[model samples]
Structure formats: structure tokens, C-alpha cells
Target: MSENRIYLASKSPRRKELLQQVGIAYEVLLLRDAPPRGPDVTEIVLPGEKPQAYVARVTQEKADMAWKVIQLRGLPQRPVLAADTTVVLGEQILGKPANRDAAIAMLSQLAGQTHQVLTSIAVRSALGLHTVTQCSDVSFAAMNQAEIAAYCDTSEPYDKAGGYGIQGAAARYIANIRGSYSGIMGLPIFETCQLLEAAGVRTTTDRSL
Candidate 1:
């Protein structure tokens, strides 16, 4: 592996695309597909855990687990990058919806409301593990039952946080966004570049430096 490449510890295609967009070469670590005996990073929110805490903890665990996998598999030594995204309305954390009805309910609640999209990233390098969380405020237009149901009927809402993908059909419902758009998608490019640079990995954006 080249020194410019790192290990991406996520299965999200959005994350992969974001890295590719920035010319940050990475090899997918596929943590979930690792050996059955390997540790898995559970997304369960502990009792009384705040959204920020939960996201940060999960991101760190993912990076840690990826690092362990590297040692176990004898893969090349490189920085391990991991991230976790969650949608938060009030104090409640909205994770991926289980089914069509749940997706509809989540979209219904988010309609005409402003919610927070929290994406936490962790990078484990020779120096140690580093993490950062980016919070973006997304406001949705008022959506009618038919609109919500129609969106729920599509496959876009099933695998994404808050039961919607901001980059997909759900973009029509987004009224405004106050933070990093890439953060809302899954990875915050600015913060990700900062972490990768700190780990001695160069991105295309580093060319001007």
C-alpha cells in the first residue's frame, strides 16, 4: 500500500464516494465482513447516552476494531478511518428505519421540522486515535402523508439514517442546511481532510500546501 492510502472502516458507499471525490485513496476494511470471532461495533445507544456521546463512542470503537483487524490479518500498516452518522430530533436519536411503516413514521416526524445530523469520524494512526464530530442542521419542508408515504415506498430510505438520504429523493424535502453538506451525507470532507493530513496521508486538496 502506498503511504498516501489509508484503510476505510465503513461500508457506506457515500463515504467511499466522498473520499474518492477528494482524491483520498483508501482500501475498504469491511469491518462487518471480518471473521465471525472478530469484535463488532454495535450501534445500540446506551441508556442516558447523549447523541454526541453515542456517535463519538461508536466511531472510536469502529476505528479501534479496524486497527485490531489490521493486526490480525497482517495487512499493511496504515491509518484506519471510521465514522458513524445519526439523526437527532430533540433528545431522541433516529437510527435506520426497519421497514416501510417505520420509514414513513420517521419521515412524518421530520417533516416541517429542523433536526440535527451528527457525523463523528475517527482516524487511528501510529500516533494514536483521533476523532471529531460535525453537526449539521437540516430543515425539512412540510410534507403531506402522501408525499411521506411515496418516499417511504422508494428504496432510498431503508439504509440511511433518519430513514432518508439527503442526497437522494429526500433532497426535495430539505428546505435548508446550516452546516457541512457532506457531513449530512455521511462524511465531512473538511474535517476528514484535516484528520488524514494529521495522520501523514495526503489528499488532492493538499496539493496547494
Candidate 2:
């Protein structure tokens, strides 16, 4: 049993890649699919809930749920990590787009403006649950209808918050960024490292890699 391994509760490829990049040993925890009519929605922003609070709540909830799964499955006793990211423009929180039109609308609103990207990472262990939220400002250059249309054609916007990914073709559309780049990708490296460390998970740096 590797003492450095933790259970990751996210299915995000980006999160997996980020963990690998940081040399954090992790095992993906498979969650049962939610039924279509279930009331277990994780993205319903409460009335008057701020973006920061919403993301933090959701991330902790994910970590809590993942921990429960670990106990149920009798998986190896290890810390479980989960994260959530959202894009905020003013008071509105832009979540993952539901369709092409929605994606286009999101990108359109984000064009020529700066928005906040909030990523909350949570880790649960026998000691308890620990969490951190990191915020970053991303500025998008003014984009025309043609540019938006062409980018939307690739369907990259559909899976990302704010309808654009800073690491992808949308990179050309970004004018500036003032925070952790990994936070925009889904997991904020610094904040994630802090949470993992607090949960007693040794990081790559601790191993002197």
C-alpha cells in the first residue's frame, strides 16, 4: 500500500492531468451515476448565494460524498480529494454550458471583459475535511462574432465554464490572467497542495522530486 496515494473523487481529465503534473499519487474513485430524476443536483445555485460560497459548498459536498463512497466500498483508508471550479462575471456564476447556444451566450458575455475564476479544493480523511478556495482574474480580449462562431464550431466551449478554456484555442482570446493558471483549468495547484498537506497527504515537493 502506497502511503502517498489518495482517492480522487473527480472524473475530470484536467484534474487527473494536474495531479500527474504535480506528481501527486492518486486513484480515481468511481461514483455511481446519478439517476435522471434524482434530487441530488450539485449545481443548483441557491437564491442569493455568492459565487465563492457556492463553489466552496459544492466542493466540500463532493469531498464528503466521495468519502462516504470510500467507506461503502471498503476501499483502502486514504484521503479523498475533490474540487469544483466556476466562472463569475459580476454576480452571475457561469457553470458548464448545457448546449451550443448557451455556450455561445456565455462566451459572448465574457468577450472583452474580465471575470473571476473560483476553484475550491477539498480533502477528507480520518482527521476530518479540509478545503480551500482560490480566485483568479481572467481577461478576455474583444472577440467578434466570426471568432466566436469558429471557436464554438469546435465544441470546446461546451465542457468548460465561461464557455472557453484558457489552455485551449481560447488562449488567443485571453488578454491577461492574474492568478493560479491551474485554478482556471479546474484545480488550483497551490490551494490543492495546501489542502492535501493539511489532510496529511505527502506531496511531490515533500518527497523532494
Candidate 3:
């Protein structure tokens, strides 16, 4: 592994794009079930687990698992980065919609309301696990049933939290956002750079420095 390169333990193309946009060289570390037939990181929220805690825990588990994978495979040692994002409507955590109906329902609840998008990132390094969480408040414009249903019919909502993607067609429906937009997209560039730098992983900014 190059001194500047690290491992990204996420399947989200958005995360990859964000890392690339910031000139962070990373190889994707795909975590898959071996003989266990289960995921390394269970995304299920524990009983009464707060949204913040849930996201943070999941992200940490991912990074930890990625580190273990490196050791198991005898791969070069490097920082493993992972992240999880969720949408919160009050106390409820809105994960990825299961189907079109579910997507419609989630969008209906979010219409004409403000919700919080929480993204937690964790990196496992030789020192230990370093983590950070970014929360962004997003307000949605009022959407009628027809509009909601039409939007849900598209392919964007099913794969994203809160039944929508801020950078997709759903962007038009967003009234405002307060906080890191990249965080809402699943990776906050500023915070990610901080963690990576702290872990001694060089980025484009480091080259300029």
C-alpha cells in the first residue's frame, strides 16, 4: 500500500466519489459473508438505541471488521474508513425504504417538515478507532400525494435513507439544509480529511502543504 493510500470499507458509490473528489487515494475493502452467512456489521438498531448511537456503532463495527479482514488476509496495514448515514424524523430512524410503498410513506412523513440527517464516520488505525459524527438539518418543501408517489416511483428513493437522495431528483424537493452537505451525502469531506490526516494518511491537501 502506498503511504498516502488507505482502505474504504463502504459500498456506497457516493462515498467513493466524495473521497475521489477530495483526492483521497483509497482501495475499496468489500466486506462480505464467508461461511457465517451473516454480515460482519449488523445494521439492526438495538432496543432503544438512539439514532446517533446506532449510526456511530455501525460505523465503528464496519471499520473494525475491515481491520480484521486485512489481518485475516495478510494484506498491508493501513487505516480502514467506514461510515453510516441515517435520517431521523423526531425519534424515529428512517433507514433505506424497503419498497415503493414504504418509500412513499417515508416521504409523506418528511414532507413539509424538517428532519436530521446523521452521518457517522469511523477509521481504524494502528493507534485505535477514531470517529466523528456529522448532523445536518434538512427541510423539505410541501409535497402532495401525487408528487410523493411520483418521486417514489423513481429508482433514487429505494436505495437512500429518508426515501430520498439530496443530490438526485429529490434535490428539488429539499427546501434548505444547514450543515455539511457532503455529510448528508454519506461522507463529510472536512471531517474525513481531519481523521485521515490524524491517522497519517496523506491527501491532496497534504501534497499542497
Best by lDDT: 1
Instruction: Supply the TM-score for candidate 3.
Output: 0.95
How well is each residue in 1-209 modelled by candidate 3, as lDDT tens digits? 25788999988999999998988888998778453223467899999999999999999988888888887777799999999999999989999999999999999999999999999999898878899999999999999999999998889998898889999999998999999999999999999989987888876564567
Evaluate model 1: give its lDDT: 0.92
> Higher TM-score: candidate 2 or 3?
3
Which ranges of candidate 2 are over 4 A from the true structure? 33-41, 205-209
The residue-level lDDT of candidate 3 at 76 comes to 91
lDDT of each: 0.92, 0.87, 0.90
- The list of candidate 3 runs beyond 4 A from truth reads 33-39, 206-208
The superposed Cα distance between candidate 1 and the true structure at residue 128, in angstroms, equals 0.7
Clashing pairs in 2: none
Question: 1 or 3: which has the higher lDDT?
Answer: 1
lDDT tens string, model 2, 184-207? 999998888888888877775655
Q: Model 3, residue 129: displacement in angstroms?
A: 0.9
lDDT (tens digit, per residue) of candidate 1 on 1-209: 25678999988999999999988888998876746335877899999999999999999999998898888888788999999999999989999999999999999999999999999999998878889999999999999999999999899999999999999989998999999999999999999999987887877665677
